[model samples]
Target: MDTTDDARTRIDTTVAHPARRYNYWLGGKDHFAADRASGDAIAAAMPGVKLMAVENRAFMGRAVRYLAEQGIRQFLDIGTGIPAPNNTHEIAQSVDPSSRVVYVDNDPIVLTHARALLTSAPGGANAYIDGDLRDPEAILAHPDLPATLDLSRPVALLLVAVLHFIREDEHPERIIETLTAALAPGSYLVASHATWEYLPAEVIAALTRNNTDGRFQARTAARFAELLAPFDLVEPGIESVAYWHADDVPGPRPSAEEVACFGAVARIR
Candidate 1:
């Protein structure tokens, strides 16, 4: 299907999408009734889900800011969910106004709203692609990606809270290695993923039952760590999402149970 047709067919408001459900968690208005229902169901089961989403967003901001501070200006954010406040481009450009970002996602609904994340400072650039993380080459070779980001230079590759959708059969580690190998030396690979290891049995069962698409297969922290093995992890390696170089913002920090995701930033070298 063409872009518009693709969007119309793929965006099923009848069921909840991870992006839309996440938008619901973040209090964004871009979700449907089904999305809200599923999100609420998950929240009811896992009491700390809303806080987990919030902490994930905060971790994204901190990770991007740290990459920018390290003088990395180009970003390739895959599995970029619905546009939310303090997105990667927003955080990166805030630190370096000249930073460039190219966002990619498989969801057509996200593509429909991709323009929302494309706004950038005059000297910087932002672009979006209707692509999937399963197909890293398509993302890497997309015309817009090379047009906006200099892959030969250090770029930050973000895979936050999305890899769980990729099943073990998909060979996630090989996929990550392929993507990281393509980046220039000194480039950063950042990711956060959900885990059953941190959750209670009842909550985990409820979450698994509620996952409509069977897209997520929550793994152990050990499997999550293996995903980062190809790269050199930065300081505070593989900490809880909330504690990943967390800074005390004005608001209250989330509790340990509120952070079911693990986050890490690693260099391609």
Candidate 2:
């Protein structure tokens, strides 16, 4: 990871970063004015945008917990946004104190706050790598990652709420393949991605037109599932993040339209 000054110099406060915007949506204080503007603009187009963010976050927590309960003690979480409550390591370590996790993110601001994500339990270990999801090879080769997680073991790969930012031209499927190829069989792929399938055509058009940063590219359920090729979807399949393993959540959950994201956990086959 870069030093604090190096990371700070790399950060462009003028532009809105996805991690910062997401932090703003989650009501965190790490975002700049640009992020708030971007978030507010999206919210104006889709009133339930905040709900989508919240539901997606909840899905990540549930997925991590489920993986931990299934005896997965190692996690590689990419696109780790600003450290929020019950982060990957926190949830996994809560299940098993000896759990180990490696978090990767591209945002320099996130790197500045990486210390928060590195706080592991007494028996567990956590590491943060300043890397991009678009470059799987680089992330996989990061020294901290290898030191924290053993690829030969059945580690869980968490891509929650981050794949949508990967444009089609970037070949997100290839990225998934590259990363999963490094993991051993029995490794789990847990992901939640934004989808346009639940939105009306007009709403989609409006949102698309309003998208100025071109940071988000919502995919359909089928497309998202395709990215998980060679991996079998766990029971319940790809469904709204609001409802995916959400039995423990309070009643009167938001509608699919309100939380327009598909989430699922799949296993390497």
Best by lDDT: 2
User: Clashing pairs in model 2?
Assistant: none
What's the CA error at residue 138 for candidate 2, in Å?
Answer: 0.6
Worst 10 residues of 2 by lDDT: 206-215
In the range 175-249, model 2's lDDT, one tens digit per residue, is 999999999999999999988877777888888987776768899888887887678999898889999898879
Q: Per-residue lDDT of 55-121 in model 1, one digit per residue for the tens?
A: 8998999999989999999999998898988988899989989999999887788877766888898
The pairs that clash in candidate 1 are: none
Candidate 1 achieves a global lDDT of: 0.86
Query: TM-score winner among the candidates?
Result: 2
Number of clashes found in candidate 1 = 0
lDDT of each: 0.86, 0.90
Question: Per-prediction RMSD in angstroms?
Answer: 1.7, 1.3
